[model samples]
Target: MLKFIALRLLQGMLVLLGIYAVTFVLVAATPGSPFSSERAIAPEILAQIEAFYGYDKPLGERFITSLGNVLQGEFGPSAVYANRTVTQIIAESFPVSIKLGSISLLLALVLGVPAGILAAVKRNTWLDYLPMSVSMAGICLPTFVMGPLLALVFGLILKMLPVAGWYGPEYVVLPATTLGLYYAAYFARLTRGGMLEMLNQDWVRTARAKGVPEHTIIWKHCLKGGLIPAITFLGPALAGIISGSFVVETIFQIPGLGQWFVRAALNRDDFLVLGLTVLFAAMIVIMNLLVDIVQVALNPRLKYD
Candidate 1:
């Protein structure tokens, strides 16, 4: 187990390094200078600014320096934001994203698992058709479209929730629901399919023949194996949510890492963009590793090498 964990960690580090290098090169190659603007500054002043930020250094030297600083846990200063470090910005913004994502994920599991299970158990009945239909509608509606419709219904028409801003607990409900519902559709489908397959397996027949309670057979014998697909989807889904959903953040006017990442790209704030990219890459890698560990734990038949 120790060896498996170490191997996964090593692979994750390599993947993160590759992501950093790709993001660095792409951002470096992009056209606009971080200092460029609609208004012109004096050449000497611009030169002074460039020198201060080490933009005057050779490209290779800058990349090497940035990589070294990253290894030492220094993301350096934000070029556009006066007197702010990349680390500081991420620190301030990420908690909100985490809160939003956690609630959204909880909502997905709560709604999705039961719906999927019901659909699987009742195959051809109304119980099956109703939830599956809703799940299908969810899968069809993208978040961009869904966010506005939800905002219009709940926030504008019904006036039950705030349409924008992240002020209090109520502020999160719409955005979290919007994000959660979208993924819940996918989870519902995956779970239903997995449960159907598990229910048809020989063990299920054996349990039924031995007079095991139907609910116990379904919950204990089937659900454990059936949930594997949903668990697999969860790793990256959680990472993406926790990193911040850019569209949802923008639509709701939430101040999170997603908003900052968009601003950094548009304004050509290379350090901030690079920092966010690396952070997201790290999250994805770590979450996937955790998911793999959980999968192995749940299924002893699976071996780690």
Candidate 2:
């Protein structure tokens, strides 16, 4: 098990390194810098800007310097953010993103699990229809579209929730729902499938024959078996949310990591972009690794080591 975990960890590291390389290359290939979008500058001012950012250096040299900086936990500063370092940008933005993602994850689990269980238990009835229909609707609506629609209905028409701004729990409701519903659909589908399969297994049949209570058989035996695959999906799902809800946060103007991430990528803020990219990629990779370990531990009969 340790060997398996070690191997997976190495693989995860390599994958994140590749993701970092791709993002860096794309950022380097962009036509202009964030400074290019600014007003015309005198030669001395240009020199100052270039020198401050090491933009005047050769590309190879800059890349090497940037790599060294990354090793030292220096993500560099944002030219657009008035001398704020990428680390500082993330420091402020991460909390909001984390809060949003955590809320969304809770919502996804709360909605998805019960819906999926009911859908499976009452397979031929309206309960099944309801969850499937909801899942379809959720998958059909991207967060970009859903975020605004929610704002319109819940915020504008009803005026129950705030239309914009990240104030507190109420402020989180729409964005969390908008981000979570799609993932809920995904989890629901996965859970339904896993449950259907587990329900048919020989062990489940034996449990029923031995007069085990239906609830115990379903909850204790079937649920754990059903959860293994869902657990895998849940890990990455969580990582994605943790990185930030770009559309939901943006639509609501939450001023989270997603806001800076989008702006940095669009504005060609190299250091900021690279930093955010690496942060996101690293999170995803780490989550996946944790999923692998958990999957192995839960199914002890399976042997990878």
CA lDDT of every candidate? 0.91, 0.84
Stretches off by above 4 angstroms in model 2 are: 1-7
lDDT of 1 at 134: 95
What is the lDDT, from 0 to 100, of the residue 218 in candidate 2?
A: 82
Tell me how many clashing residue pairs each candidate has. Answer: 0, 0
Top candidate on TM-score is 1
lDDT assessment of candidate 2: 0.84
The per-residue C-alpha lDDT of model 1 at residue 192 equals 94
Q: How do the residues 150-173 of candidate 2 rate in per-residue lDDT, one tens digit apiece?
A: 889999999999988987879988
My TM-score estimates for the predictions, one after another, are 0.97, 0.92
Worst 10 residues of 2 by lDDT: 32-41
Candidate 1: segments with Cα more than 4 A from true spot: none
